[model samples]
Target: AMAGLTTIRGLVPAIPHAPVAARMPSEITSREVLFVKSLDALQRRSQLSLRGSNLAAFAGRRTEDERSRLKRVRNKEDRKQAFKDFRAVATVVSALFAGLAVYLKYSDSELLYDFDITDDAVSIIAGLLFAISFQYSSPLQLLLVFFGKFETERPADWVAARIAGVDDPKAMTEYNAPAYAQVLSTALIGALGLVTASSLSKLGDTWSLSTAVGTAFLSFLYEVGRPKRLSSEEVVAREEQWSDFRQFAEARLVKAGSCHESEIFDAFVAAFPQYRDDTEGKAAFKQLRRFVYQWNPTAERTPYGFYKNVALSSTFEKGKTSALDS
Candidate 1:
């Protein structure tokens, strides 16, 4: 009976040992499962961080693009406002000058007043105001006011050529001394007529009328005989060439096919705002516009030949000398 009890006790201890060994594998498996879950969580966090970085980069690019677009829009608006301001100032000054001219004309006692204190003062004031108005006006308008119709048509080419140091080919074509002498003689004759008319007017006689008529006729003849230091023919030719060039330029602008003519015109005006008062500059612009019209023949009315002749007299002088030498 004692031997049987010892064997039973040994069996009990063996049973407990077998259970402990089996439980060790289950605990190890549980720890491995937890580690795997932690790794998965860490991987998910890394992916999220990468996605956030990409999103931020995209937003930064979008912001830069918006800023660039805004800058362009602001610049365009500023240019437009500047042009409007210039025009407004010019219009106001022009009106004032027109009023002054009317006042002077009606207030004068004589049919033609000499440039006395009153006359000189009015002229000075009017000229100053006119000059101011022309400051921001288009070059074409200013040229017309200063040089009349004689210098407008080809002023650009003449100026360009002069700037480019081209010698006037027509200067020597006419007799220089004779041309100037004729102009001086004509001017002197006109002055004499003016004097005589004034005297006759003071005397309350009809002599003023006869003297004026005679002076007019004499002046006309003198102008006809006067040799141009710059040949009129050359001036005309240059003007025509400039006109052609202008047409070509205009055609290119039109071909650009922009919907905004005003925008284009404004850009042109902006580029040459000083052209409004620069006689030659304005003429160049007018010629360009006219050329465009001629090319298309469907454009609006253009300036008359008034601003076409303000060329460098040196050109004509050279031509005259050449002719004399020849």
Candidate 2:
């Protein structure tokens, strides 16, 4: 009797998805049956995994996706190495300029008189160049890359991993600790540049202004030339994926007549489990919300905060009445 009861319980539908089963008419459509089955499968898989499941065979698909992502990251790293190489060159150049600044500060160089450039001017120029180059190849930036922080090429996956399964205090205070190294390194580098400029400057006071000027100028240039982070191919692929998602969402909304935010979010996550990452989930939600608003210029909100196209008002009303009846 207990074995029979256990079997019966196992066969019963989950509460969250029961409405679909209950609302089925005597002659149910194939699409409705498929949707119910998909929901059941997702629920079952979610019980097994901490992260929710999707409609597709997530295990196999995720493995394949991981391989593809690794390949892309490898390619990105190859491209990023070029920037690092440039920065390394900048580091060397900055060192050389620093040496020149020191040499001019000590030596009574006749060259400055020949060129009509005052020693103060030459010192400021060398210091400016050093500061600019150092911005690209700062000691702190190089060191942070080793620990995998504050890098343009660093993937979000690692940060997510670091904070995973930790309490709020541990997550903030331990895993996601403050960036003391960055601050210290920045201050040291700035001080070195200022001293180099001041020691070499005749006025001994202009280094402060010169370093600031260099920082502002280099920051502007860096901003202009900074990488977009996504490759051309990735950008195109992302657009295609989003297009596919938009189509799926539109079809699902039309089938349901209307949907609340949670329903839409669940539907999207069911279709694209890869976006389950916290940051990605937020982005996907924002995109989906924008799509919803754009789908119907005059959208109406149901009593339960569901959104529906005004054109589908009749269908939405019928669905709502049926749901309430069930």
Candidate 3:
């Protein structure tokens, strides 16, 4: 582990990744140093266990204890990977925000427009740069990758793992907890960046700091907290979903003037068993409730609040009656 840390310190600058290089600092207080040192010691002692015939034996003949331990390790690794992807998405967003801040900071303070460079030329150049950015490794590319129609890389077989009975043979695939941790972790990383940037600039008054912090928190949720089932769809499709099921629930509640929270949850689960039973079902459930609550803020937040909340929400009541009346 220590050796790997040392290698990273020496080799990171050589790599062409500016973001990572920018983050690297004095390593004396880094926990990664200790982690690397431990890893190095273990590797030197029994590297063969990870290679050759020993590897096959390790893979095939895991004891019950080893299997359990490995399951936890696998879950942690999966969460780590998911964090990385979400963070990258947020990074693009944050970078764009920083660029915007730079422009805003300089727009009126300096005369960027002179006789040498007219505002028209500046506008043209900006448009050209924006157009060029879409084709390169920029937020525009990521936006397309996120929202544009693409070939489904996830094959049907990946979801076909028989993970019904935990008491039975351990499924080759593993499930993870909800994205609560991922959201929190991503939010913290963003907060840290905001703080560091503010401290360095020495210009983070309450309003500016608040804006930076809010941007970070919001970008993290936009990128990470949304469930896969609820994401990667057209805005129209997503809006349709919101209106469709929200109305469905509202209709059911109007008859009773309210329903139990469990009733609503069961209704959704019944309609989308595949989604509700999948690994991310809990996350999807949370997303559904959050969406419902947000669209109709009068919705209750108690165990029995759904029906009453929905019934009381004037926004929901108006929409529900108008739709049904139509």
Candidate 4:
């Protein structure tokens, strides 16, 4: 401990014996700094708050100006969120490539048991970029952790409908917003991943192009085998028929003395509620409708089918006999 203390004491000039209360933290660190050794402004700015001096004010102003230089967007909050998300994404991507570059560079140099200027420069650049990228580590780390949540938990169909201009209030709250947030998060991660892989490795070269293409191909493969259910169009059509049938059978139809076709269909559904919404029930209803139509299309009042009669199936009534007539 004494040796380490002496080593540090040698680097720092002797602080003349002074009262403990009299020594300030800045006085200790700033003495050597006045000699003009290159100090990193951004590195210090990260620790300093918005206060004091021209340098601090300059840093604050530059930060604000840097924020405004992004693409013009209608929503200020949205643009701000986008910047945070992408920066996080970039940090993760840079770390990944930097780590890989370290191993690759070290391994390649090991074959001859020597290092060259090119290898050293590449490794240094990668290390520096990784450090800068991860300067504010927490946000990007959280972004990585949440990536899976967005990809898996978001409701896809409702989000799709919202994107296509469906403005349903309930859907917006229950499905659209949550799902949209997830999708946006996932997109930011993807954008960062692609940009990092391509830019760092060199665009249009085998590594970048192959990385992009492979990611897309794997995504395609995953989707192609995924189990898909009924389409939105088919669901809409089926529900329309189901709704109309439900209203007609339960509300409009009644078992009155007239024994109308609608009444008979309603009776069937009432007896078999399990099949009430099934295709079989719909077929039976359509069959009963034929019995309710009169032979003359111009007539205001049509005869009702009180009982089963095959003759009622025909529109022609020249000499058709009904079992109900007996």
- Specify the highest-lDDT model's number: 2
For each of the candidates, the C-alpha root-mean-square deviation to the true structure, in angstroms, is 28.1, 15.9, 30.1, 38.9
Better of 3 and 4 by TM-score: 3
Residue 311, model 4, lDDT: 27
Task: Give stretches of model 4 more than 4 Å off.
Answer: 1-164, 167-197, 200-207, 227-233, 241-326
Among all windows of ten consecutive residues in candidate 1, which has the lowest summed lDDT? 304-313
TM-score of each: 0.23, 0.35, 0.25, 0.21
Model 4 lDDT tens row, 194-219:
33543545433344435444444443
Clashes (N, CA, C under 3 Å) per candidate: 27, 0, 6, 0
Model 4 worst lDDT window (10 residues) = 307-316
Give a tens-digit lDDT track for model 1, residues 1-326: 33544555445444435566567787765565555555556666667887987875786587668658866875676567446534543454445445545665667566434523234443334333323322222235334544543322222223323444447624332222243333333333223333333445554344444444443343334333433333444467556556545543443343211122233334445554544333334455555555445544543331332112111123334443222223
C-alpha lDDT (0 to 100) for residue 226 of candidate 1: 32
Error in Å for residue 281 of model 1: 49
> What is the C-alpha local distance difference test score of each model?
0.42, 0.51, 0.43, 0.42
lDDT tens digits by residue: candidate 3, 1-326: 54665576566434535576457674732555565566566665655645655755554455445657866876677678667654543554355445544564567645432311122333323322322222112233244456753322111111212122223222222223224433333333333443344343334234333444444343343444333321223344446556656766555444323444555666666665544433335545556666666656675555544444443233445554222223
